[model samples]
Target chain A: MKLLELQAACAAYGQSQVLWSIDMEVEQGAAVALIGRNGVGKTTLLNAIAGVQKLTGGHLKFGGEDLTATPAHGRARAGIGFVPQGRHVFPHLTVMENLTVGLAALAGRKAVKESGIASHIFDLFPKLTQIKNRKAGLLSGGEQQQLAIGRALAGQPRLLLLDEPTEGIQPNVVQQIEAALRRIRTELGVTILIVEQYLDFAWSFAEAYHVMQRGRIIRSGSTAMESASEISHLVNI
Target chain B: MHESAFLIGQVFNGISVASLFVMAALGLALSFGLMRVINMAHGEMLMLGGYLAYLTLLVVPGPLGILVAMPVAFLGAAFLGGILELTVIHRLSTRPLDTLLATWGVSLILQQAARNLFGAIGVQVVAPTWLDHTISFSTGILSGLTLPDTRLFILLVAALILGGVALLINKTRLGLYVRAVNQDRPTAAALGVNARLVDLTVFALGTGVAGLAGVILALLGPVTPTVGQSYIVPAFLVVILGGLGSLVGTTIASLMVGLFTALIEIYVDVSVAQVLLLVFVILFIQIRPQGVIAVRSRALEG
Candidate 1:
């Protein structure tokens, strides 16, 4: 069954339509890659799905519930975690504080206590635990990315939406992120929907791939079957 | 010997005045520090709180009135803050400059309304009998120094409120969410922090604290329709000089401003002292554009 589905989703910013009837789906525990070149509405699509941006038309269903009209906070409450591009971590807050911010959003104090989400997030990113007291602004790019992902995981999201997780990141740190994503998928059973301009890094973790161009999906295939040349040709890398 | 005694008396008077300024400025610091909203009408909010305290005394007689007025003024200002957030502030959330203008307009309207209802003349606020006395300490060379019980009460209240606000921001869950939103609003929202709601609550909390300051102001002296205007510049200076959104920075700045202003008033003419303070603050800003404590770097990133 589809854990998340976007049926002919149309979105816009102000007057210009940025996404044109975009359709996509991700099954439970599946790692789906959204591969697209710059300005192909990848970020807009992610924003729309996360309810940060309004949809011009069509519907969004998460865990079989229609989420088209839901506000961004409501979407988050309904378990849609988003890691926006540029790893926007709270600079004023320490790493632990950033993680606790997400934990505070649990349905109630009881839910937070039951989840032990902070500990689990720290366990996933051990580096975060070491520098948990350090302010997020003081961290390096790689550390910020880990804190960003850890913060999202603290919400215990059913479906995680990551936009350009590897963009501008060092290659070594990219490997660490891949390892973290693998752990999230294998250990926590968190489903991920990632938008990527970097095909090589994305294909390593994603089980399926969707290629978008000019605000619409041009191709879709299993990651195991698609060749590197095919991805390059689709994205024109 | 007599000149020394008079000088000491002037010093005590300055300390009292400084304490009041600190109270007024702390709330402004909290609001500007977290939201980056200038809240030009912050002084008016403080005046409204003072008026509320005055009104509370008229309605409820005796010491109980003073006790009730404190929380009432706070909650009342908080309610006003929440309303402003929904009607005006929410609209201007993305427009910082517009918020300044809008709140300034609100301030004018509130001041005129107060003048119409309460009259332009200052209303005398009666302190409880226990606060009307003076406390004195005597030493060999300095002789005895005297302080008003009311001023001491204000100082203690200011200290308590500041401590409470610090605890609320640092230790509590709500504080955690506020810090998160302040640090990175969009990211906080993505993490399910409910940024909008948090903004509203923070604004309300800051306004409520301002109202409490108002109640304390009323206790300190006569509360006129234009009383808030007197506090506006000092509060802004405290907030800006302390840094944009650092509460601790604001508190320290407030104390410094309070003491500095007090000392200046004693040695220099009051008007000249005011000008000097402004000039000093202007120079200080040039030196540290980010204020005494800069906000975390990520907070400034788009």
Candidate 2:
């Protein structure tokens, strides 16, 4: 079953239209990569999916439910989690506090405990447990990324959208994040959609690839089938 | 040199006044600290609590009147705060300066309404028989200064309220959500924190505390429609001096301002003392522009 679908999604920032007639989908438990160069509406696509930005004209559905009219908070409540670019963690909050903030959205403490989902986030990103007491702002870039992913996972989301998780991180941290994403897909069964500028880092983790240029997806195919030259040409690597 | 006995008396008076300021300033600080709103009308909310207490005294028996008025003032002011949140504050959340202006307008409207309904003159609030007495302790060199029971009661109540607020923010899950929202709105919203609900609840809670302060103020002395204006400046001073959004800083600042104002009123001219205090505050702000305790947030960088 399709976890998320965007039919001719169109969006804008005030007067400027950034996303034009975009269509995309992520099937259940599928790991999809949105690969594009800068200013190619990659982040804009994630924002639209997360309901943070309004669609000028389009249809957005999640698990077959029309989510076009849903607000960002309602989308969050409906299990669509977004890890925005720049790892926007609450700097003043402790790691535990950040996690707890997400946990508060659960129906009750009993449901939270019954799910054991928060522990799954911690298990995926073990560094979070050690730095639970430390403020998020003081964390390293990689730790902040982990914290950001961990925060989203705490919400027990069915569909997770990550925007440039390894954009500015070191190679070793990128590896850790890739491993965490694998575990998230295999163990927790989360449908993952990630936007990335780096083809090498993203191609190994994503099952399918969508190449966007100038606010439109120009190519879509299996990650294994796409040639390195084609990928380089698409992302201008 | 000031006489030891005189100094002791002044200290006692300062402590009592500080306790009162702490009551009023803590609520103002909490509201602004968490919400980043000046809530210029917070003082008026306090004044409303005082007026409610006064009105309650008219209907209830003397001793039980003040007791009954406390919760009523809290709920009344909380409801008003909630209404303001829905009507004005909710729209002005992103615009701090606009919120200050809008709430100030609300405060003016409330004050003028009070003036029309209750008359412009101050209405006296009588203390219950238990609080009417004074307690004195004896020392060898000089007799220890006496303190009013009502003042002592107010002090205890302030301590309790501050303690409760501290616990709520530091320990409770709701507080964790508030702190998260204060630190980063976008991140909190992404985490499913429902930033709007948290904002409304925090504003209402802060205003409720203000109402409690108002009730305590009513018990302290007379209340007038314009009474809120008097505390508005001091509340701002306390919030800024203590550090933005730091409860501990607010408590210490409240006591310091209270004691300083009381001492100045005693030894120096009240107006001159206020001027000196203002100068000191200005100097302090110049030294620590972020406040005694800074509001830590990534958004603050840009």
Candidate 3:
């Protein structure tokens, strides 16, 4: 089943027209990679799906419900979790506090045991447990990324949107994140749509790939059939 | 009175005044820290609270009338503040200067409306019998000093409000949302926090606190239309001295302003003391541009 679908979606940043009419779809529980070069509207597309960027002319359907008019917060409550490009975490808040903030989406819904979420997140990112009490601003880049992803997962969204999650991280932490992403998809049954620059990382996780160029999807194919070098050449060109 | 007694009396007066400053400045700091906009009409919320308390006392005339008036004022001012935010502040949210000017216009319109409804002279809210007593020293060096029960009541009420607000910001779920949005609006909204709701809540809550301060201010003076104006300037100074809307910073700044005013009044005239307070604030900001508690944020403007 199609968990997410965008039809002729168009977005603009104050008349600059960043995303032209674009169509896309993601199946339930599928890991899809949106790969493109810099300034290719990948982040903008992610933002439009996350409801942060206002769609100029388009319809977004999530789980078969038309979400074009839904605001960003409404989209979040409706099982769309967004981890932005910069990993914008509340710096002054402790790691625990930041995680608790994600639980805000659960308001007006069935009560879920917070301890369950906490233990699951801690199990995935064990390093978070050791520095749970420390302020988020004091954390390293990789640690902040972990906290950002963990914070989003606390809401237990069915669909997760990540923008450049592996950007500016050590290789060891990148591997840890990749492993966690694998579990988040397999164990929790989350559907992921990640915007990635690193071809190897994206190719390793995503089953299908969409290459965006000049505000349009120029190519789409199964990841297993395509070579990373060929795709990298297309993006770099 | 002895020299020590005189000093002690002045210090007590300073603390009493400081409590009022704390009440007035808290809302200003919190909302300013979050929205980066000042509600010039915030002073009018205090006036509205004082007016609401007066109206409440008319209906519930008894020893507990003042107590009943407290909640009435809070709700009344909070409701009005919420309306103002939706109608005025929200529309001009992106333009800080426009918001300030527009709210100032609102303050004027409200002042005119009050003068038309209640009269230009203003009304008085009588203190209950329970607050009529005074603590006096009949013997020793403090023989001439007297502590009025009304001021003590104000102090107690201020302390309760401070404690309540601190708990709300630090412990509650709403508070967590508030902190999250205050730190990062776009991110919080993306995370399912209704940033608009948080803004409205804080704006209303700030006005509500001002209303509480209004009730206590009525105890100190007549509930006049311009009563809020007298304190609003000092409250702005407190917000400027307090760092990035921090409660602790605002409280400390209030104490500093209150004590400085009271202590310097012993040496200079009231008008001169006001000038000195402004100078002190200017100097303080020159030394610490980020206010008392520096907030580390990723937002370039913040």
Candidate 4:
């Protein structure tokens, strides 16, 4: 079943239009990657999906429920967890406090207790447990990225949207994140839609890929059919 | 010995005044920190609290009347603040200058309303008999230093409130949401934090604190409509000097302003001390523009 769908999605930053009538769909429990060069409205599309960027014109649906008019927080409560680019972690808050913020998404919704969600997150990222009390700002790039993803997962989102999760991190931690994403999808059965500039990581993690350029999906296919080098070459990487 | 004792007394006065400033400035600081909108009418929350305390005491008269008035004033002011947030501040949140002007207008209207309701002359809240005595010092360098129980009570109440606020911000789930929202609104919202609800809660909470300040103010003097006006400026200074709406920053800034005002008044008149206080703030800002505690964030530098 399709867990997410976007029809004629259009978004703009002020008067400069970034996303133009983009249509996309992701099946439940599928890991999909959205790849594009800089300035190709990839991040904007993710923002639109996360409900942070308002769709100037479009219809968005999650789990067959219309979500076009839903605000960001509403989208979050409706099971859309967004790990935005740059890992916008709450700097002043401690690691545990940051994770606790994810529980806030489940205010009126049925969910596991705080400890239940937290221990799951810690199991996913053991590094977080050791430095749970440390302020998020003091964390390195990789740690912050992990925290951002863990923070989103703490909400127990059915659909997770990650934008460049592997950006500016150590290779070892990047592998760790990739491994976590695989488990998050295969074991946890969470649907994943990731926007990435890293072709290698995108190819390995996502079962399907959509290439976006100038706010529209230009090409999409199963990862089994097309190689990362081909898509990388086509997009002139 | 007398001189030293007088200095000690002024220090106590500074602490008392600091406590008042903390209550007045906290709400402004929190809301401003979160929304980046200055509430020009925040002073009215204090006024409302004072008036509410006056009215509550009328019905529940006794030594515990002031205690009863505290929560009444807090809730009343908080309700008014919530209304102000919904009606005016929320509408003008994006346009900060417009919010200022609108809230300024609201402040004027509230002042007028108070004037019409209770008269411009102001009403008094007599401190209970329990607060009537003073702790006196007689021999030593601190001799002649006299501390009133009312002032001590104010100090204790302020401390408790401050502790409560601190705990709320640091330890609670709500505080976690508040911190997240303060740092990144869009991101926090994306994480399913109802930013608007947080704003309403904080705005109301801040105003409630202001109301509590008002009740305390009434103990020191008359509960006039414009009473908040006198402290509003200093409260703004405290917020400015405190950084990015951080609680620690606000508390420290309040102490600095309160102590500076009190100590300066020793050598100069109240008016001159006020000028010196402004000058001190200017100089202080020049050195550390970020305020007492700097909050580092990846977004929203302003």
Give the range of the ten consecutive residues with the poorest summed lDDT in model 2 chain A.
A107-116
Candidate 1 per-residue lDDT, tens place, B3-120, comes to 5665676666756665666667766666665677888778887898999999999999787788899999999999998898889988987899999999999999999999999999
Q: Which portions of model 3 miss their true places by more than 4 Å?
A: A110-118, B297-302
Q: Give the distance in Å from residue A189's predicted Cα in candidate 2 to where it truly belongs.
A: 1.0
Measured against the native two-chain assembly using Cα atoms, what DockQ does each of the candidate structures obtain, in the order listed? 0.56, 0.53, 0.59, 0.62
Give the per-residue lDDT digits (tens) of candidate 2, residues A1-237: 998999999999989999999998899999999988899999999988887778999899998999998777777777888899998877877788777777644533333442434577878888888999997778889998998898888788889999999878999998899899899999989999999887876778888999999999998999888755667876884
Consecutive 10-residue window with the lowest summed lDDT within model 3 chain B: B293-302
- Model 3 Cα lDDT, one tens digit per residue, A31-74: 99999888989999999988888999989999999999999888
Q: TM-scores of the first chain across all predictions?
A: 0.94, 0.94, 0.95, 0.96
Across residues B1-302, which tens digit of lDDT does each residue of candidate 3 receive?
77777788888889899999999998899999899999999899889989998999999999999999999999999999999999999999989999999999999999999999999898999999999999988788887788899889988999999999999999998999999998888888888899999999999999999999999998888988888999999999988898869899999988899999999999999999999999999999999988887654344221
User: Which parts of model 2 are misplaced by more than 4 Å?
Assistant: A108-117, B142-144, B297-302
Model 2 chain B weakest lDDT span, ten residues long: B293-302
lDDT of 4 by residue, B1-302 (tens): 49989998999999999999999999999998899999999998899999998999999999999999999999999999999999999988779989989999999999999999999999999999999999998988888899999899989999999999999998888888898998889999999999999999999999999999999999999999899999999999999999869899999999999899899999999999999999999999999989898865434231
The sequence of per-residue lDDT tens digits that candidate 4 reaches over residues A23-61 is 999999899999888889989999999999999998999
TM-score of each: 0.92, 0.93, 0.97, 0.96
Model 1 alpha-carbon drift over 4 Å, by segment? A108-114, B1-15, B296-302
Q: Mind giving the per-residue lDDT tens digits that candidate 2 earns over B78-147?
A: 8998999899977887899999899899999999999998999989888889888988757654466677
Q: How would you order the candidates by DockQ, starting with the best?
A: 4, 3, 1, 2
Q: Better model by lDDT, 1 or 4?
A: 4
Clash numbers, per candidate: 1, 0, 0, 0
Ranking by lDDT: 4, 3, 2, 1
Give chain B TM-scores in order. 0.92, 0.93, 0.96, 0.97
Provide C-alpha RMSD values for all models, in order.
2.6, 2.5, 1.9, 1.9
